[model samples]
Target chain A: MTEDVPVKVNGLNHWFGKGEARKQALFDVNLKVAGGSLTVLVGPSGSGKTTLLTLAGCLRDVQHGSIRLLGQELNGAHSDLQRALRRRLGFIFQAHNLHGSLTALQNVLMGLQVHGRSDPVLQAKAARHILTLLGLGDRMDYLPDNLSGGQKQRVAVARALVGNPDIVFADEPTAALDRESGATVVQMLKRLGQVRGTTTVMVTHDNRILELADRIVTLEDGRIVNDTAP
Target chain B: MSLLLQALFGRLPIGWLQLTHNRTRFAAALAGVAFANVLVFVQLGIMNSMATATLKPYGFFQADIMISASDANSMTEGSNVARQWMYQAMADPDVVAGTGLFVATVTWQRTDKALGLTTYGIDPTQPIFLSPEMATRAATLQLPNSGILDRFTRGLPRDETAAIRPQSPLSFEANNITLTLYDTFAGGGGFGGDGFMMVSDQTFLQQFPARSSGAPDHILLQVAAGADPDVVAARLRDLVSDKSLRIRSYAQAAAEDLSYQQTKRPTGIIFGFGVVIGVLVGIVIVYQVLSTDVADHLSEYATFKAIGYGQGFFLSVVFEQALVLGMLGFVPGLAVASLLLWAMASATTLPLAMTAGMAVTVFIGTVVACSLSGAIATRRLVAADPADLF
Candidate 1:
């Protein structure tokens, strides 16, 4: 795992449809994310930063580019391989899309359950431990509707980390939080990537938190324009 | 497989939690299902009750064979057999006993009041296989023009010396007959209403002067023990080459009656339509319900899909929800049907019995309907590209 590149994208181009209505969402994007590194992508709205992250995460279908995660080429791979990529990748969204019907702990355990794990007690314990580490130890039984904004985001972070994914993708994860809560979330993500050796790619418009990134890449339009780290 | 099962059953708590979270929506959906069930079950119950009412007349009979006019296809209208057919039938070694039966519609009177009724004329000496209650009542019944009156037709006595004044318009004399409401048979023969009378042959002839020629309409036969009715019936047909009369074993008659009900009556057609409607309604409702629920949780589903949850897994969850609703709705539907049948049975002579086979059939039908809807509704999840979530 130490020698493996967590994510690599080269000349990735994606279009929505055919004919005149076709619109390019990502264009000639090239980037590499090293293992155990915190990479932040900063861009304006619709700058394709999220598209780049999704492409690297194997969440979107790539049309005209190559992507390799953990030494496995995603382009032209079988459905099973693609599924394996998703299983090993963790994703966090800004909205904290936790299920309203499930409690905070159950939402975290849902990650493991989705990956076909059947041990309820083990899943529960792992989810509880992750939530506890994220400062949500007392809110395990709280449903999404019952949780505050900051608590919900923490629960979402717990869910992303519960499976111990090789790579974690966070898109504007702190956009809905206040300044204090947002800083705390950024610190937690930095520690997760730097201390635990989990490669993390975050897309955000908040440049104030750029200092927490091990490497920061700037994107304009759909291509990377600058990089602060070699 | 175990994981799938766990997810399938594990979702029950989630489903309940969601339902409780929104009580109004849950109640609305449940009510929709319950209403659909009630419509289907009530329609089916009516059809079943109609069939039972149609067959009730034969239920009380104990004849092994029924010999009617050769062209007679039903009990309502058939050519008459000669009274001597009874003697001829009894003469056969295989025949242990035989009776003449006269069936006709006649107008009866109790002191100037008159009403039409179906008359069953039987030999007083021979046993009437159709209704023993009617047989017992026949003994005490007097001949026509001077006899007892049925509870429905019996009126107060009238003056006997009364005569019409001179130059009055001609008035027809109404036949006075006795009627005893000893037996009440259900009145469903693919027709509208029911009224029947059972009387002795002498009394019937006296009342219905047009039928006085002693020509029996049908002859019922009782086969001797260890006798084959089919063989005896074939032999009888040979003996009576007159194509005017037909002889049929009881089993054949029962089969023909069942076939007639299935093919000729509207019960089968209506019930079949009802079942089709039920399936279609169930599919639409279940599909809409599960599909809406999925759509409501689209983001959550996308999250699961991003975490390697296969299309099959999500499909299973949808199927489980449909099945749960189907089972829940089915229990109440069947219970309502049973209650309706019981109430109908008490009010009318219809026999509405629910068998294990019917229950199984309904259960399978509900499951299949729900599963089909579930499968169709979840196609969106299968084709969903997780990349869109970003």
Candidate 2:
């Protein structure tokens, strides 16, 4: 384990279901992601791209092997340890799951609350700053129901970044955005890596943004087929 | 205060936000809580009033101890006892004073309507009962066939003064004997009937016609100035040779009466039933509201978990919603129940009032009910796996 490696995996395997219906999703996966680097996991659907990402991101329990995230081993970790590790990480779901009841700024502020930030003024300023940078400055008060799909996705990005997480794990973050918004999001993630030493691990199918990734790892049939450096 | 506000209303006002996000759903949930409060409060109020009414007649007399015929289960069923027993009990030096009480039922007949009345025999000069309203007019009862009626009787007109003393010295027939109403007092009637008329023993015997003059129904005894009633009552039992009489302190008697009302009467059973139903209804409504809210926000909750929030955070938010519903729902329910209780008291002449104890009881009950509902509804949220959101 080196200080430059933010995420490291060895012989990780995961299975879904039980008894005779059990089927393996990822098999003996091994990888290492560098710190302050934009790493993208690219593969067709059901090819273990998501399983590996979720396992390394602490969203799923590591079933068969070791996952060391930010120097903490995640195999059979304590619940409190897992939760503490999760606090230093951020996630953006494919569906862009923003709370419908909250305004755009409120949704972003939720990210700060999970970290136990109680200052309303400071939270609002950080949330507003992120939303403004994401090109949602005018829509800060709008609810998810009232915002466009692109604007809603941008809000999710702002929420993921507002807490100043050490690592960001995104699943299809740019799927709902236009070309311009997509470029802007990728640029923001890249800039965060350069300026704040933040690491990003994303699962994507976008071809145009693949060029921006610091490293691209491709998988097939739950096996890593190619690991390329840009 | 500043810190408290920050704790409740800071960066994420999640509880208030979730509840008020949908106006229609929030209003419906509030209505459900208020409805439950009204049911519990009204039924409990009526039940309490009924129990109080059973012991009310006894409450008016200032006696340290009371003696009733062993066969007399309640004041409503007072039977004639040997007056010599009262004289025997008074032989103890702890006994300060004793008075014979006469209780009998009579048919009261006016112009076109007839009603039942409980006639009481009291020697007004002995100060056996407390009635300040009719105190100044006590002399009127010394006149033959004259008695003071209870103003709390149900059959009387709303404007009782107009019908009670209308010119010709208001006379009514009791058991076919003419009795004149000399004054009205503000004591409530017992469970046996809607009216009471207090007269002297001579007047009671005349009204009953068949009753003997020497046999009184009950005996009320006052203890010596510094003596304990329970001890004196116990001593009286040993002094009196009659093993068939029931002797107890006034407090003991009231407790016995209340216990009987609770165990043997339908009012108590019905009120208990109403309380069960109210709690059940509250649980269902709150569970439905919280369940649906959780279902709607399932993915969002998972997002919270994925972003590093623990189960405690989510539980706190849901419980906060429950607390809000409980408090907001209680306000309207208490107000409505208060108005309804007043109307019921006026209409039924029962001693119903919104007591402070009742308010606190119902408020605590509402919060507990809502909290239980919240706990039940959060099963799915707590069991949610953040991996499912993928």
Candidate 3:
């Protein structure tokens, strides 16, 4: 019932494939993420860091054990209920998954549209405001194909932030960005946490932004081996 | 209506945008759909024209009821019916007038083309066929070796058809006789014959010289204004009581002949096969286009699913694309079909015309075809799990 806890996991387990080919990806994972703070998950490849983040973000079904997201238990939850929770959270993928055909502004507007149908002018204003804040104001009309790699990732950040979601789950959001752009994205997330009480769970191995995190959870072999305040 | 407009052009234009984004792919899909539409339209058009064109000669027959040889299956296959059947049909109270006509096909040689021309021998004194040209030239056919040539002959030389006037000599090469053309009439040529000539009974006998004089090919009867032709025909059938006579109202007979041509003839079957092939081709082409589109956009759709957009939203987008293809594809199809039909009609003198009903039917048919393809292609999108984003 604690509203300050944005995400909590206990005995979390997940597997990939089926039959004899099946392999366990996560085993006995446990964690708690605080509200109004930036929590980064650090781990090597195939260590189940992305698996735990996606489970917390409702991107995949919780196969075993309990995951409480935004104060609602996700274990055995109805698909519709899970989808409802997903709308309150934002996701930024490792590849900066913006539609190639859509303009920068249109890509941001897609975030707002998924929430519900609203006045188009108001939606456009919101999308424009987020892009401006992310330093993409000048490239609002440029399609993803025309934008550089760093600019495209910034647009993805703008899209994830346009809806003002309660929580943001980012998977390697800065992988495609240069030092300045990567720092800009981390600073923006920190500002959102401080100003709007938004919670952020980012999965990244970049050490440059690790110093700014309020807390860091390190996963090794599907288990959280380290949890410490910076 | 305003809400629907917004759905189509505003909030829901994602389908349109996505389709239009790849210009080459969009153009290719439109071409595929249009080709299928054209195939169906032309096949149905020609089939419809065949049924209508063959009825052209019957349109000239003014009788409400007709008596033909009992075993006769179609207009061109008339056998001998004893002349006594006509007199017997005239005895019915509903019969106001009656006439007997003889039909035979013979070799016709004009300066331009040599082909078989069907000849109708009409009693000069009786009102046999209702034709504007015949009203003026009926009696002229009573002269020896005189007949009226049909003006609208199939594949006839345009110049010769125009130049042959009254008193023009037409050689009946089969009988070694040359018949003088009394005049030209409008109705007579179609599937029934390449061309036709109307002559008096005496002239017909002279031209053929082999046909029996005592029997006629068919008996035409005019019913009283208040009497139902079906009832009159039934009465005439009973009155004649001759096993060799088959009596029917004009409408019933024409319907029978049309049904036979559409279902039993090779031309009709070929056209039906063409329509089936058109639909099959549409399925294959549209399936390829939509399948490729879904495959290209699978990741985007997975993102949509991950972001809380339900399966219903993506499905609507796909169907919207289908509807656009259906409607836009029809434009080129209709344009091309109308041009082809005009050319066919001019070249063959067939009664082919595009009706508003035909356009609407083909458009609806195209929508159904494309929608079916879209439905099949959407399976890939539906199987896209948001888990792929991880």
Best by DockQ: 2
Ranking of models by TM-score = 2, 3, 1
Model 2 agreement with the true structure over B242-326: per-residue lDDT tens digits:
8878899988887887877766767667777887898788889988998899888888898899888888888777888898899
User: Can you write out model 1's per-residue Cα lDDT over A74-152, one digit (the tens) per residue?
Assistant: 8877777878888887888887888898889888987777666467787788988888877788999998999998899
Tell me how many residue pairs clash in candidate 3: 0
Which residue pairs in model 1 clash with each other? A59-B387, B69-B246, B70-B244, B70-B245, B70-B246
Q: Which lDDT tens digits does candidate 3 get at residues B1-390? A: 324634664553566767888999899889988888889888888878878766766765677887888766667675888777778778888888877778888677656777677888877766455555565777787777888788777766667677776546544454787777757777534665777778888888887677766787877788888999999887776778695577999888888778777888788788889988988898788888888888888888888777788877787777778888888888998999898888877877776778788899898888898889888888989667777786
- DockQ for the candidate 1 complex? 0.52
Model 1 Cα lDDT, one tens digit per residue, B1-390:
335445656632444454445667766666656556666666666666556645554554557787887656555457888867767777788888877777776664445566455556666666446456545544443333222222222121212102212222112234644333322322322232234455667766776777755577777788988999999988887776465677888667666666666557576677768867876887788788877887787777787778787777777677766676677778877777677767765454344555565567777777787788878888767555666677
- Candidate 2 chain B: 10-residue stretch with minimal lDDT: B1-10
Off by over 4 Å in 2: A1-3, B1-11, B71-73, B78-80, B129-137, B160-168, B189-191, B213-215
State the lDDT at A115 in candidate 2. Answer: 82
| Candidates ranked, most accurate by lDDT first | 2, 3, 1
- Estimated TM-score per prediction? 0.81, 0.94, 0.90
DockQ of each: 0.52, 0.76, 0.57
Query: Model 3's DockQ?
Result: 0.57
User: In model 1, how large is the Cα lDDT of residue B148?
Assistant: 24
